[model samples]
Target: MRKISYNQYQFKVLLYDVPKKIFILLFLFIFTLILLYINLEKSEQIAKKHERLKVSESTLFIDNILDMKKDDIPKNSIFFLDTTRMKSPNKVRDLTLRQACSIESAAVTNENVKVFIVLVSPYKTLDQVKYTPAMEAILSYKNVHVNSMNLLQFSADALYDNFVANGNLLKSRFVKQHTSDFVRMLILIKYGGTYIDTDMIVRKKLKDLPSNFICRDHGFLNAAIIRLQNNLGKKVGKLFIDDLIRNFNGSEWGWNGPLMLTRVLTDLCQTSNVNEMINCNGFHVLNEDICYPINGLEWNQLFNEQHASKVLQSVEHSYFVHFWNKLSQHEKIACNSSAAYAQLARKFCPKTFSLCHEYF
Candidate 1:
């Protein structure tokens, strides 16, 4: 073979090397394009999911409003307030399993009495709301109606309109609690029906209870469960609202809630005895056994497996069970736990309970 010149050798190396480099660069370019395409696809999917969620939420909001408008508030209406604001569709709403249990229990026990869940969001519109699995399950009940209420608007029309105007709600340390206290009274005044706390699990029909009544807890009368029949012009609810506004204290927690009820009832009934106060001053003061079978101090008994049976037995004659959510919110109730609350939910709110894969 003839010896190749350095120039020829260099030219030969360049010819092969150039093609290899070009091929490698082309491969990298293709890979980068593929990666970019994949990222774009993923981004599109996420964006579409968000958009669909928005549309679904909007439809649900509109449907809730329309449903409320179409369904007239009946004489035997029981109202529950979803006072917590939902941050996003991704964020779990207030309609948790426990809260839904209350709605479900009320709806099931009082089939004739329309159960109205007033979704109250002062800042955000209903279009921004999202329902959890628990809410959906309870909504399936024929007696249950999910509705929207603007806090400001409702307060404006309430007897204690000045309470909202004075910015007392904003000044309260416990805004949600204070707002709920005010809103429930407003609901009773306007609708002239029962206003039950979202934490209560009703085992009996509230429609059968006295037209104007409030349940007792240990020492104080709780606003957890209240009923008022609308009398022409002067409603019993007006009394509660007026008293609530008159004695409204923003600093103390229960000052605007159970304490407020106790104060009002004490003045109206003219006695501290809850039993004697029954049918006193045109309203009944229900015994603790009726709604608060398990007191807040004994709230753990409902969650403790050892006390479940005893707790259940105790509440046999009770109308409903108040789990004292504020005290037990951090306490987990396993789906298969033999606790009283779990058992109650399993029986009364089966659909909501079933949705809990592990714990509620």
Candidate 2:
């Protein structure tokens, strides 16, 4: 090869370094872009995300040591609730104080939601659900009291919507032993907010209970989680009452409330398609889990062993808890269920099961 001059050597070295410099620059630029994309994704979703609140064993430990007392309800917030008795002859597991603690521990997990309990009872038996000191203290939320007018107000509606004065007159009668439940939710319209059942405690703060629509445990919506716009909710309630009364002859639709509400609101989809009706189902949707059978084929209500397993498998996550029906399942796995659930409960609330006594 011909000998190269010094100037050419210097130029060659500079040329050689150029590609290396470009490659380094390119790698750094790409890495920076990836990081930017990640931050952007998180920032965009921050509003919808739960803001990452935690409820762990540490909270439970502190709770056990601290003698937490019920602070006086400073606000005179009117909760138009029908009262419910704590223990019924039908209930299988004794809903003891330990259960309350378990429920309380479950509740504290959610920072976004404040539980609201609506109680409906006979005018005379109001005290049954009202003065349970353990419950009152453990419930770090609001409670509402209402009258069920009659025992049949909640369950007899579908049967009597046509025959009786109200839409669910007869069905309401059957379920109305806890009438405040159905009726007091109307107050959510005028009162403006969410209705959290006493039976349901927070396992976590659900950032989106699918806010655009009310959610059901099943694929469809249920009434247990009623989300109504202030004035709109009141009107829906009034219409339900009036329609029930007008159809005094009774509706054979049976006592399925969430379904009936969906039926009642079917008119809203007049111009829209059937799918549109489904989209708007949230307006009158109920908590499908409570409304439908847990083990059934209802896709939204698919909760149980399978549901929990799937959740554990997924890192991004979906669904939580192995909720048991107080009235439905008994002579079964009440004390002993999932080891994960048992351990989780024990880890978070050691006294919950421990505090359980055969009081009821």
Candidate 3:
């Protein structure tokens, strides 16, 4: 063999080491890839845990099941009024003493239940609307909640389309009362709670009442104090709403109000005899005594001074007294007097009774 130079020998040695160096680099690259994959997996697991924690934080665990607790839940009683429907801010027609009495009575009587007053715009909060002494008293209660809902702001979903169409179509001919009936139904269905008329004065804790129930007034099933559930009540509400839209007859006075509900009840029960309690799909059609202890004809006795004793005695066992404000709205409640309305207001709504002189 010929003698090799030192540079040549070094070149050969370098050539021999090329394969080992490439193997080492390949191993290092593979190891780095493995480490990256392991780190990515750990990060992914942490992200999943964070998402689960967020969900757990937002949802409420009731009876071992997750339930979304919205602002409308926990057995609330709702009242609707159009004080802010068509008026300037702060100059709107404030809730009348009678209305305030009704609200305050509910707030005081139902200490365990939440009372909500749903007003129409341009009122957004309790502060924005004109506050009467009675309203202030009711608002001061811890269980009372005030909300402002606009008819135009209502959702236009399938149920709402019929609702909106029926309301807007009847706007030119019908009064705000017609639209209020529709709103009450929609609210009860969507929120699964109670809807009480502004003329009603609650005399008992409504939380103990059945979840899905309606009352009858003067041989007719009424929606004055409607309490419904989320699941089945939603279906019933949708049915009534659709029926109103399908058979909207604005020409008649109570067509959309009582008559529509009567027709729906008739169809639901397959009988026209709603004079007594009728149970339909766990929904109770309660007797008038539960809400309307005094019928429409007897409604005048509530404000009659001589009938004060009789009215108080009559509503002793009643949960609420429907004053039939439509007819009695013109009647004035006397302060420091022995009238039935006066007596009831003083007992249940002392704030409104104290401020009665200003309104009278």
Give one digit per residue, the lDDT tens place, for model 2 in 1-360.
Answer: 999999999999999999999999999999999999999898757622321121342211111001112232111122223233322322211234434544454445543334333333322222123224444444433221112223233223323322323434334444442243345443453344554433332344444454323444544444444545444555666555454344422234233454555556666544222234545433534343323334223222212344545433431232233333344233222344443334344444444544434311
Reference-based TM-score of each model: 0.78, 0.49, 0.74
Ten-residue region with minimum lDDT total, candidate 1: 62-71
Q: Give the per-residue lDDT digits (tens) of candidate 3, residues 1-360.
A: 999999999999999999999999999999999999999999877743322222242221111001223553464555555543523334444577778788888888877776667665421332244444655666677776555555544534223654454445445255456667677776677667888888988888876777778888878777777877768788888778888777877667688778888888887877787774488767778877678889998988988888888888888888999999889888865576677777777888887767766433
Q: What would the TM-score be for candidate 3 when compared with the true structure? A: 0.74
Ranking by TM-score: 1, 3, 2
For 141-249, candidate 1 gives per-residue lDDT tens digits of 8777766765665666554556776876766777778888888877766667788888888898765677778877776778888787757213656766677788778
Query: Over 4 Å off in model 2, which ranges?
Result: 1-106, 111-114, 125-137, 140-173, 177-181, 198-201, 206-212, 216-219, 244-256, 271-308, 311-327, 334-351, 354-360
TM-score of 1: 0.78
What's the candidate order when arranged by decreasing lDDT? Answer: 1, 3, 2
The lDDT values for all models are 0.75, 0.40, 0.69
Which candidate leads in lDDT?
A: 1
Clashes of 1: 0
Residue 21 lDDT, candidate 3, scale 0-100? 100
